[model samples]
Target: MASTTTVPALKADRPLLGIAFMLAAGLLFTLLDTAVKWLTQSYSPVQVVWARYAGHMLVLGGYLLILGWPRCREIMASVESLPGQFVRGLLLLAASTFAFLAFRELPLLQVYVINFSSPLLVTLLAIPLLSERVTAARGIAVAVGFVGVVIAVGPVDWRAQPAALLPFGMALCFALYQLATRRFGRNDHPLASLFYAGLAGALVSSLVVPFFWSPVALGDTPLFLLVGTLGAISQLGLIMAMRCAPASLVSPFLYLQIVWATVSGYLVFGDVPLLETYLGAVLIIGAGIFLATRKR
Candidate 1:
């Protein structure tokens, strides 16, 4: 077998820095998702999502103002693929909406376990969309991941727990979102992509929120703003991490979110995953890591 190792474009000495940033980003993402889950108890998913994007826009807008509009305009004009950028933003919006709904409807741990399936989904999708070769190890990994999902989900009495569909849908949308990010996000500036995505989300959700709008209670505003800030920070950190390291190295760290989700769910909501859930999560995360690390 040929060695598939390639020299990393980034400095070897800086791997720790990349890893640290990625871990921090993962933690922030977990916190963002957890906050959405918490707010869901008192607010509709639409309302929670709207608040998230609204806060994100306000923060980014302030940052842009500080940098000056002309600089922002120059940054925007530097992009060659506005249509691709817009599509990526649209996919992100859909993924966020579905994920918020999942958090609202399911336990945070369950929602994250399902969302973690995105890496596996990305692997499978890459075969066709990315023309990446899928080796036997990857095939086995995919099979094992699916089995883990079954074990995690356990005796899907879908008729009884129709809400289960929401997480699964969130997973699918998120997978698609990641794929879009890989495809369209390369040419775009990370900050620009973040700004556009937040703007797109805010505009789309704002239009939808009127139909489902309930007046925001006084106490929830802080939580809402925190969620958005966390969301933006997490995404920006993720982009920086990916730029610094290969996906195979960085992707495994995402499983850390599962740990955070489980602990947070227990601490916050007194929710515990069943034994099967733990087994499934272990299988899925393990298989994903194995597949991601396998020599090409």
Candidate 2:
């Protein structure tokens, strides 16, 4: 009986561990975004994106080399679901490009809040796209989340510049990208999808980089490399988290990234959002958590 009880307890801990991993992955990704924004002040957004993908490829390639060609080939060839993979990759590329633009124009936390709307969008999209039933709880969650977004937008000062639209576009594209990822998840190995995504992003960015390429300073090279490596690690951790838990359960944990971003923004840039921003963030997070806890 003691062994049985211990086993159940251990099983219970697994989901918590998965949540922790998801949170860490989100934090890493947020850091990567912040770093890119910093770099963009001195380099082109395309240049930073290219460096990120190039670095990702190098890290993945090194890992594959250590793991051996056979395993690498197996993973790459595991792409039985090529069409879905390609679609997901295309959507991701669009999302990444827009996100880079958003980072260039907006504060980190503001950009993050806008992007956080993706989960709610995904929830709504899943209904029509996946033909999943939308329950009352989900409807309420979605409504509340949107309300939070409205609150967050209250202090934006949009008339000063219309570039704010970039982040909203980024959010929409990212939402679609996540939806595509769900479709791909039904058929492909997570690592396999990631490998292909890295390949696609690298190739696309490489082509664009040459047109906009500016010489990098020695000091900046290390930062670029760090951004790429962290991005790769974050992707890996996100895959693991998704594999270990249901999307809904893991999805809510992403909002914790806002907490990380808030602290980082304060420390790194002396940025402080308005009270409405915090209130909105809390509402959106609470709504997401409510949705995550609802019984299907």
Clashes within 3 Å, all models in order: 0, 0
Highest lDDT against the true fold, candidate: 2
TM-score of 1: 0.88
- Candidate 2 local lDDT, 1-296, one digit each (tens): 00111101112325666677788888898889889888988888888888888888898888888989888788878665676677666676777788888788788888888887877877777666654456887788888988998888675567886767777888877676665555554345667877777787888888889898889999988999998898788877776665555455566677777898899889888889889889999899998788777875
* lDDT of candidate 1 over 1-296, digit per residue (tens): 01132322433424445566678987998899888998888888888888888888888888889989889997777555576566766777787888888788788888777777776776777566545567887778778988887788788777987877777777776666555554555446677877877777888889989888877778987898898788788877766665554444455567678789888999998998999988998888788678645766
CA lDDT, every model vs. true structure? 0.73, 0.76
Q: Tell me each candidate's TM-score.
A: 0.88, 0.90
- Residue 37 accuracy (lDDT) in model 1: 90
How does model 1 fare in lDDT? 0.73
- The segments of candidate 2 whose C-alpha lies over 4 angstroms from its true place after superposition are 1-18, 155-159
Provide C-alpha RMSD values for all models, in order: 4.5, 6.8
